[model samples]
Target: MTQQASLVALQERVAAVNDVLNATSVLTWDSRTMMPAGGAETRGHQIATLTRIARDLLLAPETERALEEAERAVLEFAEDSAERRMVQQTRHAVEHHKRVPASLIQERAALRTVAQAAWIEARSKSDFSIFSSFLAKTVELSRAYADCIGWNGHPYDAMVSIYELGETAASLKDLFKELRAGLLPILDDARSRPQPRSDFLFRDFPEEGQRAFGLSLAERLGYDFRRGRLDTTVHPFEVSFTRNDVRITTRYNRNYLPASVFGTAHETGHGLYEQGVDQAFTRTTLATDLVGLYAVGGTSFGAHESQSRLWENHIVRSRTFWQLHFPELQMHFPDQLGDVSAEEFYRAVTRVEPGFIRVEADELTYDLHIMLRVDIECALMDGSLAVNDLPEAWNAAIKRDLDLSVPNDAYGVLQDVHWSTGYIGSFPTYTIGNVMGAQLMETLRRQKPSLDASITAGEYSVLAEELRTKVWQHGRRFMRDELLERITGRRLDPAPYLAYLRSKYAA
Candidate 1:
């Protein structure tokens, strides 16, 4: 077969795999959002069936033949060319999947929905026992999967690589250590200041109003409603079937204003990344996380989180954002925020208050939350931590790190939806994203001198377009460090991020 034809043949098989995965995503999204609680078991089975089918199709002999032919066909292409990246990533995924049994994949996929359902119940009741067995099984499957993937350092390294690719437990430890050194002083300085008046933030603002404001905020930030949407979920997330149809969900807190506002912006950042991916890459390897078996366009979990954190904290939480758009927000919650000024609101949102929830954590205390999770995750994966002991470990970490006592499992071990959904090693990516987002923003400020002015004027498209060209357009063709090096002339340095925190909070 001709080189072009051979590449096309491989792409066709990949597109099929992408379709099945996307179908699975649709079901997953439904299970999380609209599905009745009673449907969890059947939904798990449905997702597992599709997941196994996708995996089988990806590992088929026909796909191997096509991949072989495409590998030779793309040899003459540039190393960074999309054609080459497609074949390289696919081959890597196929080899990686070959190491594990198909049944394991099915088991893991099936457990996610049921576990998530159990988690929701457990969290609502402030009880960990309901979810402990499911979590133990999840940890077991994760360990087995890690062994299959073969890790030299810690089994958690294998799990981390599944999401962040190149990150390991050791590397995360170093990163967290550096971050803590920089953040601790800032946290101290910020805490020393008189706290901002945030009573208005807790006033009752109806959910309808919050959703309306969130929708407007998303639109203003260049989230295309034509290709995407915002919905309410217990936990906020962004998912895309392809570049054409991306959806984001954010949970609302009627008594806490920033919850939906920042959650929407965070998930909008994720949606923007998915929507910003080049259309040509749709249904291709560039838009699909073959290893994670998820139909996503972002290169890595960290890269994706960078976008979310960038929009949520760097932009939306900035003084300029509230200064420019606070009037509209006040219009939505006139009684609640009418007496509040823009600067006061910004300070309230940005105040360095350590919180029980990671998603609602202030920027300064956020990474500490991530570090706590990573420590527990590592201990869990290595058999040093037991499932029954999770609440104690979580509470201890909170007290040691944030000087807070855990009120309940709902506010402690059961807070995050990640572990229940089998995202074992993904917690560190939140901090990674914060670092990467700051690094990218630092570079962006240097490259585009008008970045601040544009953002101040609420012209987010200025920053959005820059990211689309530099980061989003390439989809998953480049690794996280590669993207960083190409754009920032450095690879995942924490210096810029630390500098950003220092300037914002300490200095």
Candidate 2:
């Protein structure tokens, strides 16, 4: 076959596979967002089937020959052309999937569907017993899959690499140590000070007003509702079927207003990143080779986390941000916030509180939640921590780390959807993003020192446009390391982030 013919075949294959994968996303999204309890079992099988189909298409025998032809053809293009990059990406994914069986992938997907439903029930009932068996099944499956793909010594390393490419447990330990060292002193000092009274935030906030206000704030964060929408979920998250169909979810709390305002902003950050990817790369890997779109997908989990943290922590929780939006928020909940000044409100919301739920954790105490998960998950994988013992260990870790007591299983082990979804080694990425987001914000502040001024003026598009130009438009065109360096002139460093935290809270 002619080289051009091979490239054409490769594109067609990629587009076809993406269609199935996107379909899987749609079904998964529907199940989470709209599916009835009666359909959960069937939906699990349907999602699994679609996942397997996508895997099969990508691994078909003809793909290897086509990849070889396309690689040659792509090299003939300029070194930096998108077509060349796509060829490199497709090849990397094909090779990686070769290492793991398609059946295993399908099984994991099917289990995750049922497991997620189980988690919802378990969390609702606040019963760890309901989810424990599913957790064990997932851990076993994940362990097997990790062994299959390869692990140097720690099986969790392989699982983590599935998310962060080259990240390992030890490396993450080092990163966390760096983050903790910087975060600790500030946490102590802030605790010693007179804490801000934020009782207004926990007053009665009606759901409809909260949703409407959250929707408006999401758009201001640069979420394009034309290409996206917001919904409710058991656990708040964002998903993208394609650049054109990015969707976000936030679980609102009537008593705690930040859950709507900041939670929606967090998901909106993810939505904006998805919507900002160049339309040219739609239904295709952003680049070929170093990591295919799949590996790129891995990079994205962390990258996307950075976006969410930036919006949620750095911006939404900032005093200046509230200076502009406080009145608007007051209009929505005057009974609750009418007397609260922006400064007092900011201090109230950002007050450091080590909590049971990771989703609602304060910025400083948030990583404490992740640290517990990483240790517990690693132990689970290594046979040191049994699934049945998870709640005990979890409560102990929370006590040890945050000095907070776990009252029950829901707040302890059944809180997150990650375990049920067959994901491990991914928790560290949130901490990584927390640090990276801080560093990136430092760079952003330098680039646009007037960022606070614009924000205080009820303007945020400038920040959104800046991120789009520097970080979002490329999609997976670059690896995470390369993308960070390109944007910030340095790879992931926690120093800038630490420095920001100390300066902000200390002052």
Which is the leading candidate under TM-score?
A: 1
415 in model 1: Cα distance from truth in Å? 0.6
Structural similarity to truth (TM-score) of each candidate: 0.99, 0.96
Residue 288 in candidate 1, Cα distance off native in Å = 0.4
lDDT of 2 by residue, 415-465 (tens): 899998887778988988887788788888888889868777767888888
Per residue, candidate 1 scores C-alpha lDDT tens digits across 257-370 of 898999999999999999999999999999999999999999999999999999998999888888889999999888888889998998899988888998899988999999
What TM value does model 1 have?
0.99
Off by over 4 Å in 1: none
How many clashes in each structure? 0, 5
- The CA lDDT at 350 in model 1 is 90
Candidate 2: clashing pairs of residues: 85-288, 88-288, 88-289, 89-288, 89-289
Off by over 4 Å in 2: 1-5, 77-81, 287-298
Candidate 1 lDDT trough over 10 residues, lowest sum: 498-507
